[model samples]
Target chain A: MQQNEENDNPPLFKSWKGMYWLVLGALIFQIILYYAITRYFE
Target chain B: MSYIDWFVLLGTVVFITVYGIWKTRGTQNIEGYLKGNNSEKWWTICLSIMATQASAITFLSTPGQAYEDGMRFLQFYFGLPIAMVIICVTFIPIYYKLKVYTAYEFLESRFDLKTRSLAAFLFLVQRGLAAGITIYAPAIILSTILGWNINLTNICVGALVIAYTVSGGTKAVSATQKQQMAVMMGGMIIAGIVVVHMLPAQVSFGDAVQVAGEMGKLNLVNFDFSWTDRYNVWSGVTAGLFLFMSYFGTDQSQVARYLSGKSISEIRTGLLFNGLLKIPMQFIILFIGVMVFVFYQFVQPPLYFNKVETDKLANTEQAAQFRELEVKHQQNFQAKSEQVQVMVNALQAGNDTNVETARQSLNSIQEEGKSIRKEVKDLLKKANPNTEARDTDYVFISFVMQYMPVGLIGLLMAVIICAAMSSTSSELNALASTSLIDIYRRSVKKEASEKHYLNMSRLLTFAWGVLAIFFATLASRMENLIQAVNILGSIFYGTILGIFVVAFYFKYVKSNAVFWAAVLAELIVIATYVQTDIGFLWLNPIGCLLVIFFGFMFQVLFGRKLEPVEIGIEKPLKSGK
Candidate 1:
């Protein structure tokens, strides 16, 4: 059976946790931006 | 279309197809064919996953959806990033450790063969139907707008996909997707920029956006909560999360893409990349549609965007009445155009009061225009009962054909076809892989040689392509192509996701409990979909929670000590432990 040895290091982020947080942050930023667009344009 | 346009369209599509087949030649083994030799890097996996999900309908109907419904559609993807993180943490490592070809293979190891087969069968049913829609959607729209035969268009798209998919399998699907995604996004961005440029010279990009906002087309985020309201913050975050979890975690079409990654880390990277980028890409596409809405405010759009149906009514006895409606539509457009100018001037002058007044007048005229358009649609349906009365899907394509420069038109058409082929190729590849690995090889041909299985994989790929084309012929009855695809997936995805959720968690709930639990849960989900007005996204969480709930109930009641079957592999890691 083939086994995948886990690699903890990502290319850019300090850790996978960091990457996940970054993605979450991006989502929050986008939602905020869209909400701002809605309000500003309104 | 001009000769130059034909050349560009044919040149781009043929180049990509030939490149995919040529690059992936000499794939003779089942692993190489089905799993792309497990050699794919994160970038290939990223593009392949995104390409498979985008599909032709995403390119064709989404902009039009935004054009008609506003950017609220974007909220539908808000949960994707969260789902990506969850799958990366849980699903990726498990699948890689297990070395499974299909997601259902994990179910069999964790639960039982009946459970695996049930999940695989549901996938085949839903994905098979969706594969046809993937081909039919762009075919119907391109055929109508470009005056091509719909059947021939369907066959052409299906055959192009089958050619490469059957020849080189998953590798070919991934190889071609890079180019397909490039062309699809590049063409869209170009279209977006061009649409803005095509706006009246006096209307700056900001002005166009402000006009769209004033017309209520920029409603990107709605914080309000309603169970039946499809795209809102609550539904998008909670229900959308479950839907994405099921789709990326359990669906073989997506699972197969990442399963080809060279390492678990690479797969995780690929999925996370998609999660981070998918929403913004959708925003650009939807923003383009809003810009088109603004563009049409200055120009007189057709009374009906679907020329095929509208043209059919042109020679009928209803033609006179239709002409009257057309005349009224033009008058409405003229009046709305003037009001838009008033709003734009007020906006430019920085007078909030005048801007508000002009905005109100413009919105009222827009309402009158909508009523006239509705009457035209009603008349068209009365004139021909078979007409697809919904024209939102045609809005963007109509704009492209009537206004875009000739060669770019060809590029845009290629973009649509490329999207169709990229997604269909992935579907056929996944469908064949799941069918061969989970069903055929496991049940009927357990002792087949590698060469024999490889041959069967190719044969099955071709067979699924044919079946998809057959289904495409009957797809006309469905409403808006994008919504139809999502609706069909929702009907089954929740139950399938539930089975996987159980297989991962709830260790004490044995196969007997979950197998029957899944059966009951799927039936209930389907019943809910057919009988209720609950939003489709809600089905994912509903179906999954129901499975977990019932599995526990069954285990508590039955208390059966059935011995677990050893499938000649390492036992899966108990999820939490």
Candidate 2:
């Protein structure tokens, strides 16, 4: 019964674009933070 | 080291184990036993993924890696985000659609039985050795800090994790991983913050980072193109992609984490989240190490952090020489620490010339310290041949013990235990699943009922857990736990990932060709690894590419005139009727 139900539903996935954007933003944040802390904060 | 700390550490672990078992109770069949009935939410999957990757060694040795090598190691993970996207698009859909118990199970459907068995066997070998290092890494920290025997600590850490894993299976593994992640992250954040706090009152967090930067420890990104250089943009992007793909895309340890997700979306989200989170998580861990490097500039660090060897040297004829080096090291650190403060002030004033001068002075002092430390290490080796001369892995734990408050010390210790349990439990769970589904049920007892298979999985979990503990007892003689685990993986992951890549994309490749090719490629890869001094990271790509190239060559030479076998993907969770 459970297996049948799982099979019937198309797997739920979020927007790949959204995931990409979030990841890119995170990368930028890390770079900037790392730079700002080490370079300018001193 | 206090009773209060032990209480907190023991209580945290015991509670997590009990809670996990309670939450994951009623796992009656193989599905629940291995993949948690594919009913796990995204958060559960996310935490489980993180827990599996962040071993005790990450907690114990990463700071030391940062302190010694600087933050250049961070570049090694630069390819992970890209690797995640590739796995989600390529690997996830295949596993989800095929519904396989182990990732290797897909190989059988795509190619042949030999291929499936080959992949599973490789994963077992890699993860088996990895589990030992995970347990051994944290046990070293505990035994070192508390002055206990390493073997007993290894047994204790290994047994505690195995106890819970044997009882609760994948469900318990996932549930406890969530708790462990929480504790591990909390402890790390606290530890990072406390390191900043423990610095001399004159040194702000900015000053600490500035000092570290001046000492050349903040070099997070290097665009160098060298295969021999272990952590660089070229190696990280190309070779690192293959390594991550092989590890997350093909290995059962990671495959099983996503397999437990309630839906395809949840698994996808969990993986994508991991892709987003993992690089930064590693960065923070490495950053903590960077901060530690700065902290030591103001404080006089041990000439050698490895107590076992340091103690031996203390009783030797060379003890006076080592003491002289220690005194020289103290004077050098004092001068450099003062110079670093001046450098920070100059940088703050936007004076590039003074900044450059300060940097050079800091570098010269650092060079002198390195020589003295090397002298001490040589004395240690002369005093005790069996002792490790490198103590980079012990730096963070040493800081925690000497600096942190009592309550927080316990919390950080719990974090190490949690990290150990997180990775160890995942390994045990994966090993049990592979043994039962891929080997036992597939080859040994094909006619067993679901209940029987489930029982077998539990038994295998206990058996593998015991095996891991036995391996952990022998893990102490290793040089560095984190690198040792990765080196072990590099030995097998490439060929395993290679077989999967062929199974997925190379349609004309027959199972017999791929199987023989994989075997030969594995041997060649191992031979190259042992004979060469190339950085270990390169092995991942080398092993993988060798399998594909060899598999194709074998197909062209030996696969002609033989009828191709029909490869049908099987439902992994559902027992074949």
Which prediction has the highest lDDT against the true structure? 1
Model 2 DockQ reads 0.24
Please report the TM-score between candidate 1 and the true structure: 0.96
Clashing pairs in 2: A12-B265, B99-B572
Tens-place lDDT digits, model 2, residues A1-42 = 132224322223255666656665675576556555445423
Q: By DockQ, who's the top model here?
A: 1
Q: What pairs collide in candidate 1?
A: none
**Against the true structure, what is each candidate's TM-score?**
0.96, 0.93
Error of 1 at A28 (Å): 1.0
- Accuracy of chain B in candidate 2 (TM-score): 0.95
Model 1 ranges with Cα > 4 A deviation = A1-8, B476-486, B561-577
Q: Mind giving the per-residue lDDT tens digits that candidate 1 earns over B45-155? A: 999999999887788789899988999999999999999999998888778877888898888778778888899998998899889988998888888888898889999
The local distance difference test score of model 1 is: 0.88
